[model samples]
Target: LVSEEELARVEARLRSINQFAPVMHCTHSSVSVDQVLNIHGFDLQRALKASPELLNTSAAPTKHDARVSSVSLDQSAPRHLRTVQKGELDLDLLQEWIGELLNNSGEDIFRMKGVLAVAHAGKRFVYHAVHMTFNGCFDEPWDDEARESKLVFIGK
Candidate 1:
């Protein structure tokens, strides 16, 4: 079990990465099945009443610096699968890229997470960056799946 202060740090870390800390409650410190299921709905009213901290935090920690209503893209359609050449990427280079991204973002970049299929690497790696910090870890191999970089970053 964690105290409220510890959970606050966790929630802050998650918010840094564009993720929300899950809220679970029960009648007692030891939870029963029914109590767990009862809050499963996660209704706004119930959540607000349960945790007043939610009110203190920003509901949408994003940007609206511009009054622009809509953004027009250069390309009419989504461009998927922009291919890369063999030997184009390696573990070290990947790390450098992630580092540069985080460092350059300052704090405008809130949350980013993705999976990369690095070239010339056997096992896949999971990448996570939150609040100017980034980490990469060894993941299972592709097995029957294809090796490809599927990454997305959400920022201001």
Candidate 2:
């Protein structure tokens, strides 16, 4: 069960996204939503070709900066797509897929700021990271479109 503090933290984070404050691990990176959509479209196509399970995910334009959008695990995608990749033999072969992403894609990796869905301790987790360092994860899963994981990375 999510404690009141945890819920409040999540709500606060969601509410304050547009404030441009100094969030740990994430910078107030700036970019257009179209850029994010293009990145998602290209990278996810690659991810899908490498592992079909990713077809279960979706990328939608969020109301953040006109240039801010997000990638989410679609409700119809296989449950395995929601699992974090930690190893090769895992149910959906996701570990290999993520490794490929990290190894082959550098140009598309603008800046690493945003929320991530991480699976740990036998439950789904959500995390917000900025600049790839300041990070925090919650033990609950996000099942709604409004609460989906979002990250904004600006290219240098």
Candidate 3:
């Protein structure tokens, strides 16, 4: 379990990101994908284009890809596990959803972070994105001991 102070620090980091960044999200659900390319505070469109796969959910992703699990704007609420695709994802649809979140002003989103399970570079990968920033991305063997991705979002 994470300590209260640790959680507080993490939250602070998230708030900093929100103050300066704009991200993409899913309309049907609270899940959103951070545009890493545009994270240094760059063009929203360019950021979306750089990793269009992160935005859309209409294109069939490979059998394995970095995917969101679930999102919640309630900190006390447990974030349910969600996968973009049972086997693969539709990138276009996912992207469209993200775009919707960006345009919605009343969205209760405050902060988000998750571990993305991905298959890349001929190996399994794990990606962590906090707020709209890429926290970490690494390739690992499938047998490594790692917990499933978890995320907690604070509502406005």
Candidate 4:
């Protein structure tokens, strides 16, 4: 769902990636094909050395007036990893947040997703959205996996 130019535009907006958790960098699309399939020996060390900024990131600041943009929320939720402190997020509050996001957008929000750990419950919620359409449901109970919330929204 992202192109090279779009990725570049995003990369241009980063400051110190203080957390080292930017979604795109964490979710890089496999480029091994450009190596293995093309018979070019894949060299991880060479690639890392060549892209110095990937190791020390600081780039032109983002201009939100531009077409494409992003949002990151470090909202605390019960049992979630975005923060260590315990917090509560009831279903009503969850819906309120989602409603505001969809309603506030000028159809500029193309997508979103959330993995939530609810207050007073052993289960979690998984939600997805595209424009005004969204779907959500209670998922399996908490497991050994660390609960985390992740959302990605892209728009023009």
Candidate 5:
């Protein structure tokens, strides 16, 4: 096991590399699932308290590719959470864009999560990626919810 002083030094080095990125330390036996989620910017209690209508709903489509909004937990840093919304998206184009993004700026992007409304697809495409690695699958049917694509990126 590394000493606390050594850990602090390592954390400091990482922070110097990316000041806006989250730095956390956890042992396999000590870290809870909620702690993990919080590090990734998912706050369960905050989400539970949020109104259902405020969740996953997108605004009216504009001429832009997507409406964007950003937030930063630490006032010292620039915006770290970026939300992008669109009414519909082309799956092939989206994949190409993501690939390009990872190839070009993966180091700056910490994580990305999205629920996409792909053209001609009946079910929603749900994906979450950390850095350059990605995982996605067709989730539940769109049902009554608006067929809107919402993507959130957490990055430096």
Candidate 6:
């Protein structure tokens, strides 16, 4: 476990580079595994429940400046795009399009995530990508909720 003073210093450094950096959560052996997992897991449902703003697909795209190093790092800010569509999508075509996007601009794309309504499927498709690596899987059944696709991209 990091000392409180050290943690504060690290957070300060991170905020200096990117003001929007999320708060750091530290865990130790004393913490239960389930609790730690809940805190650090990449579960989108948990995230959406915590921050409903992520579902606000109608909001305008925004950009934020990020600077790592004064000498070598690119000073350009990252841009965000949120897309919302109300139709079922072809899984094969969507995969192909995502592949093409990664092929064309993977380096500039920091992260991409979406919940998709796939044609002929009862469950929602959850997709996530970081740089050139991506994965998708069928999630919980849509049940009675409206089938809508929402995608968010954060990149240069």
Error of 2 at 119 (Å): 9.7
Q: What's model 2's lDDT at 107?
A: 47
lDDT of each: 0.63, 0.44, 0.45, 0.67, 0.72, 0.74
Residue 23, candidate 5: alpha-carbon lDDT: 69
lDDT of 6: 0.74
Model 4 lDDT, residue 90, Cα? 77
For model 3, the superposed segments whose C-alpha errors exceed 4 Å read 1-96, 105-107, 119-143, 146-149
* Clashes by residue pair, model 5: none
Per-residue lDDT of candidate 3, residues 1-156 (tens digit): 567797678767876645445434335545534545434675667656656665678877657333423443332234363432222223355345544653562244444444333433323334333344333444565466442333444334
lDDT of 5 by residue, 1-156 (tens): 789899999999987754555666777657667756755665655554653433444844336323333332222233354334335788899899999998897776778887788998999999988888888989999999888776677776
Cα RMSD (Å) per model? 10.3, 18.3, 19.8, 10.3, 12.8, 11.7
True lDDT of residue 119, candidate 6: 99
lDDT of 4 by residue, 1-156 (tens): 679898776776663333222333435555544433555444656656755555554765545767777765555444454543435477798789889878888398877777777777677888888888889988898788556555566676
Order the numbered candidates by lDDT, best leading. 6, 5, 4, 1, 3, 2
Per-residue lDDT over 1-156 for candidate 6, one digit per residue giving the tens place of the 0 to 100 score:
789899899999887754544564856635556654545536667666766677798876566467311121111223232223357889999999999999998888888887888999999999889889999999999999988777767777
User: Number of the top candidate by lDDT?
Assistant: 6
Scored by Cα lDDT, where does model 3 land? 0.45
Query: Whole-model lDDT for model 4 versus the true structure?
Result: 0.67
| TM-score per candidate, chains pooled | 0.48, 0.26, 0.28, 0.47, 0.49, 0.53
Of candidates 4 and 3, the better by TM-score: 4
What's the lDDT for residue 27 in model 3?
A: 50
Clashing residue pairs in all predictions, respectively, total 1, 9, 18, 0, 0, 0
C-alpha lDDT (0 to 100) for residue 59 of candidate 3: 75
Model 4 TM-score, 2 decimals:
0.47
Name the TM-score of candidate 1: 0.48
